[model samples]
Target chain A: MPARADATSPWRSVLAPSWSLGRGADPLPTFVWPVASAVLLAAAWSLAAGRFDVTVFPSPLAVAREAMRMAADGTIWEHAGISAARLAAGFAIGGAVAVPVGLAMGLSPFFRRMMEPFTEFFRFIPAIAMVVFALIWFGIGEASKLFLIAYNAFFSIAMATEMGVARVERSRINAVLSLGGSRRDTALLVVLPSVVPYILQGMRIGMGRAFATIVSAEILAANAGLGYLIYSAREFSRMDTVVVAIVALGLLGLAADRAFVAIARRLYRHTLPEEFGP
Target chain B: MIRARFVEMVLPYLLSVAIMLGLWQLAATQVNPLFFPRLETVWRSFWSLASGDLGAQILVSLARILAGFGIASLAAVPIGLLMGTVPAVHRLLGGPVDFFRFIPPIAMIVLAVAWFGASDVAIVFLIGFSTIFIVTINTEAGVLHVVRNRIRAAQMMGAGFWQVFWLVVLPSAIPHALIGMRIAMGAAFSTIVSAEMIAGDYGLGYLLQEARTTLRTGNIFVGIVLLGMLGIMTDRVFRFLIDRFGGEHAGSR
Candidate 1:
């Protein structure tokens, strides 16, 4: 609806002075909004927590205490670091392999057809469902966890790269060829530049998948990681600890995503699209 | 002509499938059959299970996936529309959504088990948690991206707030929401196996959980195959719906 900040609507008028939906400067600036929002959210949270047992629901303060305790003992950092390293390694390997493979798929019909059945089938199999297979193949350790994350990253990146490559104009390739460029030069100089944005986007998405899959892998079978922390907390009925770990996962995921976009912008400033920009 | 067409399309797929199976068969014979089950063994295992509660397990998992995805998509659309149309709603909920959306749904299984127990409702909650934000954000973006000129046109025709919404915004936003739902469906499938494994008693994930304990590699393979089939089937259905209903607005996002 075109709700136009109607003067007759009382709620609109009341909240308008604060949130500044319409225009110009606000009584409450942009910076203060989230801080205020967080306060409101925390207040509501603590109120809800107060009605429930501590074991069932923990207040923000209680969760903070637990987070502080984990931090003090250095367990949270240990888990977070392990998870981060695993995510980095998996994302790197998956991107490195998927790009060239995806390029081949996009460029050559023979390769595309030959790879399609495998890609189409494996793409549907959830990474979480592969933990057992990972265990069976890679054994009981970091290898399985890294494999799961890389498995999750691979399909998304490869698919995006393929799409990007497919979208590259034939005329552009011809133009490169007309300029006496070799096939290698056309691919490296023309196709790769066009595909970089898509690759970066795929990497961002793959990072999210890595983060998502990492927790489950850790939860299922790991000595340490945030997922394991949450899993162990569930065993103890420590809602506070679970809450803290979840928050950590959220922060880390968001930070990694933002960091990815930031780096992509700096490195591929020309090729990176505005979607990657602020 | 028919043979040529078949060679172009059908043969490639057959070749691909054959190559993969041939490689697996080769491994089973060359390596350990315990780890690498023969195709026949896996097929037999799958057949035995398919004759059993496999139908019920598939149905249970399917029901939970649809239920969770449906609820989250439904709830998200209205909220997303509100957020897009109204500033107060957007400002109020934006921070919370930004924070919560990144929390992996697997992380919620613990809280879900604690709160709802290892039950259907818990599994549903986990799925719903995974999908809600994706749909909501997509819906909101759809609304935001709606051409301002269209709203102006509706206003020129003397459409009221509700009329303009029903006429202009909802239609424009729905396809975007559909696209979001499609992506969220991917997330939904990606998370369900874990949700079921963690807290389920009778889904395919639960079956995998059981197989995991016994080292029943054949059963595990069967479960993965079933899940893949389900995934592909749902994807086809979603694509069909998007094409049939959403049309121009669909797939643009």
Candidate 2:
């Protein structure tokens, strides 16, 4: 039999300076566009807000100074940490439950029939609409906020998992079954392995949804977390703090997403190139 | 077989609602109206809201969503095409764009409130920003997915960069862009209510929030339903466009 391709072979190329644009490849242009766009936006804001002479539209410099002060006091970090914890907790809970349910639904028609309808129904309904119920079911606290994130995460992840499992080639399943493996064994050993790539992809997308939902949940309620911090800053008319929070949220979300992509590459080393290549 | 499949989809949906309403009706007999309103009374409220001033609020919310989504598509697609066709450009901006994409657009609500002062502009900005990220990413991805071999073929035939891009790349990327636009439209609509909740003089989100505060459960239900229906309708419109223009050439790579 032919030897299986070594998994570690590609990482060497990625890490080594084998590629022309190697490790020092700077995403500076990406940064510049958003920043430039933001500045242009800020300028536009100034012109528009300047007309009213209202304090709410503080100069961008004022927002920057307030950002620096929040950084000095470490208040921003604390709030960010709280928000991150909520995001992680929700992601963990939703991912764990949805993965298994997705596997079961994919494997059995009966389970899929019983569950898919209910899931899809709720899935189409906006997460924000569930805010009222979250407040009622879990009360106005961390649990409610976490549930909202979890709610967004679970449906997307489960559907991904189900689709992933279902999409695994029947040939692969038959190959395992022909080896005298039971249905359960073939599913666990053969189908599950192939489905990890899809699961990871789903999780990446879910991270986007969950991240967005968490902010809305926090805004609706909660005293801590980044959303709360920003809303508080707004109430105090601290445009700087608001700017900082906005930058912080954007940066944190981008970082988390990149981290997820990196981990996905590390996990599914062999298929990464062909699957995602542009 | 098609009939069976249709029944399979429809029956469960009907059953779930029946079960939910039945439980709600039963629970209302024991629970307080403020916390848990009667299902029948809620139905009555929904009817009134559907027929009254609440309908205008729904229109306001829908209009804002359409305006924001329309603006996002106009701005994002051209820039996305540039990034996708140019590797050097993609290499530079891809990293920063990916990072910020995750930051919940919700964080911008504060800035929205601060800068726009709870007006239509602020709401539009929030919707536009959220939709723009997804549209940009998808547009870029779609462009990348256009077969490199095809581009080379076009170039061999003396196609210029712009010609190769417009002829080969843009057509291939449309479906993905449309998909992203669809998702973004949904996201924009979802956020509109919340955005409106803050400083909205009128809109479904404002109305829903108001109904909740006023203890009008039925109106809240109506607002939620109207929003969902609008979302579904928008999705259908996008689907129709994709069918008409894209013609399944770019459905889902």
Candidate 3:
């Protein structure tokens, strides 16, 4: 596939290049449109919020104030930090377990057939729905949250890794074999590198799951995360705080996605073409 | 001796199911029922629920998903077309779309409950929220990917703006729009459970949440297994419909 027009130049703008795809002739710069749009949206939002009681719907300023207060008092860090930790932990556990399983499945048709049923069956069960199961298995501890997030991450990573393994060039594998290289050598040297892009894409998706599950994982659990923050704040109609938490979650998700891509770009150095890769 | 086809194709499925269930049943023998219910007990619970309101509850949730997703598709597709074809609309709405889409639907539950408060509207709104941007963005992508020369060719043949849209533009995007709908529908399905848990008194999500508190592992399994079936069946039906209708263009873009 042809690389995107913007691919040759990285960091052409603050926003990711893909976001600005397919509209090149605009008179305004990229940042101008978003900023202008934000202003327009903020005005509308402010007016709408004023019509409601502030408790029910807060103005953007109110949300900003809440965010600032949370930041100043270190409340935001505590919650965000814990949530990030849980997300990272779940991501690590899921990746560690799924990568090897996916490799096995891709390498051997027998393993794929054996595992396909469970993967297909269980993937349909959304991770949020399993909050109860996680709670039951791990109690109200951190383990429940971790398990729920990790469970969500597991399928995507596994499937992506398996597909990535399938994408390895037949000739490459043949070459390795014809050179009298061992199966382990082909798997480690060739299969592993070729699969990195797919795995990274999977992990990005897994990151999305982790971000989403913050609400489910923190629900009915003890406390101390962004989800808990939202749930707790909602009890008293703390709209500002709720909005704060929601924005934090969105920004966090976006940041996590970009971080994955940036890291992938640095380590793999253009392995991900714009078309197939996320 | 077993036939090669049966051994290779059939055995893995049967064996895997057997092993997974056998291990679960074996482990359940040693654990508290709360942690792990036996397969037989779960089977019985499934029957009990199935014989009762389970079907009706699923229908209720399904109706919400359809209504919500249907409405979302209606609005999103046009807006997406506008974004693709008209630069002004893209500039106006692009930022909000990017910001809103990334905020997962689950995060919206508390606010939805706060605003709509145990109403069907809340659940429907969340379902719509979960899906609208996806459909819109995908539809936009479809439009963007349309070959420019095709539009030029249509114009050269004396096609006007609306004519060109109907003839050249909209048809090409249907497959992508269908793809978006498929994905958004799945998102809608999952969103229903969460929405119902917070807003509705009935539905699989409610049942699951209720069973969680009531400590009915059997009922919980029933909820999960049924949800899986519902998800898979919907996906298959949607794909089949798309393939049947849009066969020529199903995977073109």
Candidate 4:
């Protein structure tokens, strides 16, 4: 399949440069260095733990044990699952609304001018700052957490969609129209397909923002999730549990990002026009 | 013609703000005041706070962001330059940098609080730690984009490596570094807010938390609006600096 060529395609920009850089590297040294550094870091941490106060900074082994215990009892899974579900629902809700609104904005100059300032202003407002407003409006329920995540994701997706649509090739649309395609057909088949990669790029960024917001929201006002786990453990001075929660959050973020990459790859494979042959 | 064009350009923004305020007022009247304060009430609170405690909180948050962002920029720029210029250094540090980059700064609040004990140092550490990776990566990217021919020309002119790096490479990379610093500033600003909400006593984040506890929706709105304004104002300052210092590199990209 042929990928549409555009200077503003973020996915292409992110992936293209790295591939060329990786070609000449020896794989063995590459693997050895990262693993060696990981081992070195662990050794250093262990040494520091032995010298310093364990209450403040637990050993790597202690953290591993805590993680195992959490896993054995399924507590870690419960927290992780709740956080993941919230992230998914928020991304879905935000992306669904943002794409259509962004399309309208991209297609109509008047609409774009009307919405840009308001959205831009809100975009600068940290999602963390909205926790209180969310709490007041939605209370200390799942709604508040979801709202925070969705709000953060919405602006990112909307901006990405608008840019993507605005950058869609005029020639492609003209060709479609000359081929007897209606205006609606040109929008659905030509413009939307061309902008899919940009929308996906936006979703990727939005997912990261949503994860960050969820952590803050949970810390501020939640009974569950990884943020809550870390906060509650900290309250009791459980440094080991805190480390375990941090590691868990990192791993979950990595997993979700990898999942997104895989899904995006599949979508690109199916949707990219054949003329821009891959 | 020019006047009409200017109006056409500006009218939508004004109309949009008006429409939003109108809708907000409409909603306020329908909902309970506790949940959604009237627009006028929120506006009054905004004005009062702007002249009082909000100014102090804004200063506190700004100080924290600057401290953290300043430290991150100082550390990241040199290291990023080294990584870009030296292959061995990049290989040695790239893995760890990428790993830490995946872990959001918000997740580190727990560890930060534990290590630094809810002090300004903890917030600074959180912001700095989160920002360093971004600045480093962007700096490296910027350095990599520097025209190799220019460096070779400097070398051919009998300039030492340090001289070439300081004079040729550094100037070319400044724009990207500046962009990274702007991004880092934004990140630090938001991270400090979250950190404050968790452990602070006097920042805007703390004020928002306090307002939430007191069920003062109007005060919460004030805090949010103030934060938005602060962000916009600081961003404008960065844009001005970038344009002033970046020269040909500022908007060329």
Return the interface RMSD of model 3: 6.0
List candidate 4 stretches off by more than 4 Å. Answer: A1-28, A265-278, B152-160, B245-249
Docking class of 2: acceptable
All candidates' TM-scores? 0.94, 0.84, 0.91, 0.89
Chain A: TM-score in each model: 0.89, 0.79, 0.87, 0.85
Candidate 4 lDDT by residue in tens digits, A34-137: 77778878998899888757678899999889889999999999999999999989888888888998888898888999998878789888898988878778
* Residue-level lDDT tens digits of model 3 in B112-189: 877787688888889989889989988888777777788778778877667767887788777778888887877786
**Residue A43 in candidate 3 has what lDDT?**
98
Q: Native-contact recovery for every candidate?
A: 0.63, 0.34, 0.55, 0.54
**Top candidate, metric lDDT:** 1
Local accuracy of candidate 2 as per-residue lDDT tens digits, B118-198: 688988888888788789988988887777787778868987656766688788889878888988887787678677765
Steric collisions counted per model: 0, 4, 0, 2
B67 in model 2: Cα distance from truth in Å?
0.8
User: Candidates' DockQ values?
Assistant: 0.59, 0.36, 0.46, 0.42
Cα lDDT tens digits, model 1, A71-119, are: 9999889988888898988888888889998999988887888888988
lDDT of 1 by residue, B86-185 (tens): 7666787887987788889889888888788788898999999989998998888877777778877877888777776788888888877888888888
lDDT of 2 by residue, A78-125 (tens): 999998899899888888888999999898876687686567556766
lDDT of 1 at A266: 79
